[model samples]
Target: MTATALTMLNCHLTIPALYFRGINDMYVRHSRIQHGVGQGSFHSATVEFSATGRHRFDYVFDCGALKYAKLSPEFQYALKRVSLTKRAPGGNKAVLDLMVLSHFDADHMNGAQSLVKRYAVDRIVLPYLGVEELALIIASQADAIDKDTLKELHGLANGVGKLWKRPVTMVKTGPRKTEERVFSDDPQREPPDAERSEPPRTQEFPHPVSVVLESTGAAPGTVMLDEDNLVVGSSSAGRHDTWKLRFWNRGLHATLGEPGIWQDFERHYKRELPQTQTVVVPHHGAAPNAGARFYNPGLNHRPRVNAVISYAVRNSHGHPHPSVLADIAYAGGRLLRVTDDTRLGYQEIYLFRP
Candidate 1:
């Protein structure tokens, strides 16, 4: 009878130095707009991640997309995530669940109006536009904030659009055209190669999760959203079902296109698949949709998989790239970089560690 427990809430990521906060308003308006309205037409940007409290998470990056010219502070780092509604142990968060704001810049919606002053949100997934082009990019960032932070970023985007008023599955995770699988020893063709030939099955699209909450519930009301699409840290009842919990987050490469984002992540990894051994990587390690590969050709011959990078470490973009960590270490996977020890940070919990 041995059971150990330790739960901490604080998964943050922030990077607010984008070209030194807009490089002195662009060289002091470059000579008052040198000849008129100029200074390279303003491009000052920043913002990476945030949740701040009630589980914690924050990040915002900027430094001229970095080619290098002064970036110390250990190149900025932070991580911590563990809390997805009630109890403990992975799996479940799909009451239509999703929170993907993949691209819209600003390091991906940094402090995104603190998600309506901070969580309780239902749905807000996005890949592109629909609602008047996302309200003209939130009215050009409320004309560069300042009317009381643009009235508190429009009253926190209208209380996070009424808890992200469910129904924003504007899916988009394209870039399908990746066909390169061959591992056969051919005993004379058709079906005699049992030691090889296992990488030819693809086609499943529609991933646009920014926020979802429709769980009516066998278990996902406290917010553990299930049906398999994991988001853990704390959730129980004795934990261990829904096949060891699962979660994905790499949708929208450019928007409902690009071969339809690899046919919507090959149909959610071919219907709730990912033999749980722990997983987490989808854009935080950056690399466009491939966002740090996690290839698992059914673990053909098994015994390998070490991916858990959530980004933060000299992140002037060059994110976890080493060719996306050498293509997830050439498919056997093994990257692990939640900033690789920020003294303690990286919480997206739910590990009853069965």
Candidate 2:
């Protein structure tokens, strides 16, 4: 696509799509995916069942180690679009509808502060922050971070607090059900009055596609579905043909001291799990994150699903675990790797149809 066409698409239009971007972290890189139909690369994820452009859901997920140098131009394009369209009468509204942190690892969250500093984020989603995690952050960063900057690190430090004044929703797993809490302000009872600043603009470039696009090849040892153009399914009548993207942290059991937390959480979504068109192979396709029961005959109902594995090319952990890949293929799912060799830029799947 030409730069002009890409810019036009980013600013004026919103499409139902998904985008998975590779991360450049040193040891264990991460990736980010957004689902939406907008002209710029930074548009929040959204789902639309029809082409009428009337119905949709605005949301976004995981921010990898994307730098401001790369994201600033897209932000500017979005701002320009908003200015022209009058979508934001006063100024640019929240650029990020939701920021989901799969885990607290630096590779996954290193760009979070930069994201918040650059965009108007509406909400943040993450796994529940427990006392132990907070203690660890404090103990580890106590010397590196000074008292003056400690308060600013509340969200990163505690896993629940304001980032640029945006509310945070922390998900907690339970035996029977999952729970969530919203943190609009400081959880420590201190006033969250950090000054906000605008992200600096740089040379303009087309924002990376925020949504998924069709691909030609499939990863080895997996089956690629041919229904690339199929939108919403017939079963979705009244709903907006939603695409659910879930995140699982490998450290959940360690943090919660409950081995079954992830299992229980999966059980809660079992009914709708099969309907998911794309699954971000949890924990970069770690073995611990994928159990046999998850892909058991009855549980693996989706005839064709995209299993996304976001890992670094030179990963030290040897991610995209063999067992995990086997289970996904056995369950009749395709593998979409976000690494250099795979070059599977972003695997787009149609979530609904008219």
Q: Which candidate ranks first by lDDT, i.e. highest?
A: 2
lDDT of 1 by residue, 139-255 (tens): 665443335443433433343322233333332222333322122212123321321233321221111111112121122322221122222211111111111122223422222
lDDT of 2 by residue, 14-103 (tens): 111232111121111112343111111232334332322232334445444222213322233323332111123114633444555555
For candidate 2, give the lDDT of residue 145.
Answer: 40
TM-score on alpha carbons, each prediction: 0.22, 0.52
Best by TM-score: 2
Q: Candidate 1, which ten residues in sequence have the lowest lDDT sum?
A: 28-37
